[model samples]
Target: MADLETLKARKGAVRRSEIPSNVLTALNRGEIETVNLVEFLAVDHAKLFRSTRSQLSLDDKSAKLIAATIKKLADVGVMQRLADTGQVFHQVLDGSEDREAVYQQLAAHPSDVLRNWAAYMDAANAKLTFAQRLKRAKPFAIDDNMGVREIAWMCVRVPAADKIVSQIEKLHPFAKHKNYLMRRFAIELSRPCGVWTKHITALKERPEIAQPLLEFCREDETKYVQDSVANWLNDASKTRPDFVETLCDRWLSETNSKHTQRIAHRALRTLRKKADA
Candidate 1:
């Protein structure tokens, strides 16, 4: 084992010029404490440090150790303590099996910490290519756990809108997906008035971005699907009040699905209330 002081100095020196091999060697030699190293990485160069792990060519032994080290951090509530949500999120995501368990825990956690952490993770998707991020996020969209699915939708939302230039057209397939959750994912995430997201000014201007999923979800039986459709229309009602009223009126006239009518009524709640007043 190398001197602890020397290891600490080396860990502190991790920068753009830092070599992953040197860090791996230190960890392999048991010179640096895994807990200490992870803490340092989390506090300092979190995103860069996560990238460095891949560059290190993590073998089975090293990967096991790294994953365990990350779990240890979770065990100690290190993620909750961290000021940087991105650092906390990526560190959790870096784990192997423990990653899923932790995500479940975070999803059920109180809204403040977990929700913010999820938002940060979504923002971090900018680092991945459009296809790469979407591929990784697809599974989560339909995950049984509601919290995990919300995070998945969050991940899909920004990259689709911000990273990919053809946001609306590209998202059309999600509307037609066999899974209702996925169809809901498309509607909820891409809403013009999405909360805790960058409002798509384009939706207010074009409004057509929502067309692909709107009518499809209206015909669906799932309450979850109906809610997303209704919520999206409700959001639009805030900005495009007339458009929502007209659309809902048309849907109510055309569709006998009580579910669809229920959604349309809820979506026009504000307008109806105003008209009555």
Candidate 2:
């Protein structure tokens, strides 16, 4: 298990001023952890990054190396920028001679953001094949930190987008994975409208293009994987309501379990809401 700091110490603060200076110092040193979504959003990533480079002993020119990403991080909203920074950190550190050592350090760090960068670095290794990239992300997909788990999927999302047809069959086996995290990763990678990441439009307009992947998880045992499958179908529902409705109907008839029932209910929520409206 990760040696997490006391979240209570970092709790109940929105702005930098609202937090104690010592707490901010601890945050910079990757000592304290963000306790919730609000604290995660409130973090000053650029400042945290400065400490990161310093601690890593990166070249002084590292700022220039990542300048373009720094600009995007500032211009974009909080969540988008956080995910973007993961990519930036990966790109900058990918070629170092000590990259493996550096990534190991980041992967084991107390700060969820730095650990997320470690996952991004592995996932963004252009040398890895699509299936290999999925394998590389296994650790972060199941990371104890909620933030690390969320960013794990976003890290590999775009590259996997183009290979949906060619590699999805290979990915199908993961739907039945003993580790629910890997199962969720398989579904999230193909989500049509995954937040703060590129969409798989093909999956949206033509839900059946990846039906084999979704079909395997229709009665997934874990609520974590079930929610991912349901959310993927819900995303498709906006564009292919007929397809979603028909598939949910079939699933209802074929499967009898609280799992499938819950999935179908949540899967049709958007369509159901529209009809009621």
Candidate 3:
């Protein structure tokens, strides 16, 4: 969201007349592969102030073309300059093997390294393809808050039901994250398409993990989680009345939300139908 004036200020003192044509061409085609074009600038570091030894001894027209190209690339979000290093960085927005590999590398590293790497990657392009990114992201999920958030977002983008179920099972161990991350993870697993009976049963078996979600439902804090729980209960109640009745009774007795009450009523109805039949 940077204004033209702000972006121009960041570029600093580079006259429109000092840029190169090849650089301009690369920028126009959105093919500036290098991170910092400034590094490739014509200035000669060894020969101080020897303007004659620069890479491209350009005239006015060539320089203007280069400047315009840089401006256009920056405006279109193809590249960003790192404030700390003052290096121009290019990000791959489209699905590229190179970009996917970079995320995989980041995912394998430790948390601190991963954070810096993700920031660098994000600067290059904000969105990533889920399938390409998830293989690397899965391991990092249990290790860091940022990783958990990234994995959660990645899970939502997965189209395959089996993949989603596997991811949920893998991430279930990290259900102990602080509220912010925990809430997101919980909601992601609660999706209708993502649900698996085995996964829910596994979750229910672990009181420590299941307890927080039950608490959230009892408190009626997140409507998404509540709705998910209601759906899960209703589905389970048809085939597993004993399990459903146990959970419904436990939750209804402990919490007072209208949603929980409604869930309890549904469970009771299911039980009565079973008894009458």
Candidate 4:
């Protein structure tokens, strides 16, 4: 493993050339996570990816094809490309003789990027129903790596929103998950307006579409999860202030817990801002 202290002490590498060779090597070797967005953006993932294929000994014809595809995407942005890579890999795995063995390794890979691909593979599987896809993403949703946890929901959110009426209800377990990240993932999966992702248009208009999961999470004491629920309402408030104001009022009346109060307070920020303005 690379020296943790060395990585953390980094002044912050915004360009590939600025990265210390050892730290860059460690990152390419998938021995460490990127310290920040700059480091992440500076990484040229093609070499790291090829090394991973070699380490895994995926020498089949399918592997060769994927290798070529990955090479082409070396300079591409990670956000959309990673999801596509995951889907392509899944198609290859689904037809491979060693599907289970290969997939298990990928899902448990040391590289957060590869694990993210694994999350997207499940996300891109059209065969699975929306409910099943959410269930399948649980491990990644709760991944120790923040990057993997984010992708776990980002990749699945579209499918979930397409069937929001049914999908939100099926998320009972995730909304009430033991892990805060997983619970946050459940709410983020339904955010009417998410960061860097398309809005769930229906949710922007019909706040009720997300009520089930929001209700389950409203009392969450975890600030991380609470923030997501609050943000969900905040997003809705942009389009439906009355609904958000009404809900916030009701929540304040129904629960005196500070946690609930915190959520209610945060949820009404937009309205409060408007009133003050």
lDDT against the true structure, per candidate, is 0.60, 0.75, 0.41, 0.78
The lDDT, on a scale of 0 to 1, for candidate 3 is 0.41
What digit string (tens of lDDT, one per residue) describes model 3 on residues 107-213? 34322223233444433343534343343344434445433343333333333334444444444443334544454455445433233212444334332334444
* Residue pairs with clashing backbones, model 3: 35-88, 91-124
Candidate topping lDDT: 4
In the range 1-277, model 2's lDDT, one tens digit per residue, is: 1333454444557664576666656665677666566566666666777666655645666555664575657767865565566566677777777667667877877787778767767656678787777777778888877777887777777666777656778778777688888888888877888877877777878888888878888888898888998999999999999998999999899879889999999999999899999
Q: Of the pair 2 and 3, which is ahead by lDDT?
A: 2
Q: Identify the runs in model 2 with alpha carbons over 4 angstroms from their true place.
A: 1-5, 8-23, 50-76, 79-94
Clashes of each: 0, 0, 2, 0
- Model 3 segments beyond 4 Å from truth? 1-181, 187-217, 262-277
Each prediction's TM-score versus the true structure = 0.59, 0.82, 0.33, 0.90
| Stronger candidate by lDDT (1 vs 3) | 1
The model with the greatest TM-score is: 4
What local lDDT score does residue 243 receive in model 4, on the 0 to 100 scale? 86
**Which pairs of residues clash in candidate 4, taking residues 3 or more apart in a chain or in different chains?**
none
Candidate 4 residue-wise lDDT, 229-270, digit = tens? 999899999999988888888888998889888988999998
Q: Model 4 — TM-score against the truth?
A: 0.90
In candidate 3 the C-alpha lDDT for residue 183 amounts to 49
lDDT of 1 at 112: 23
Q: Judged by TM-score relative to the true structure, which candidate is superior, 2 or 4?
A: 4
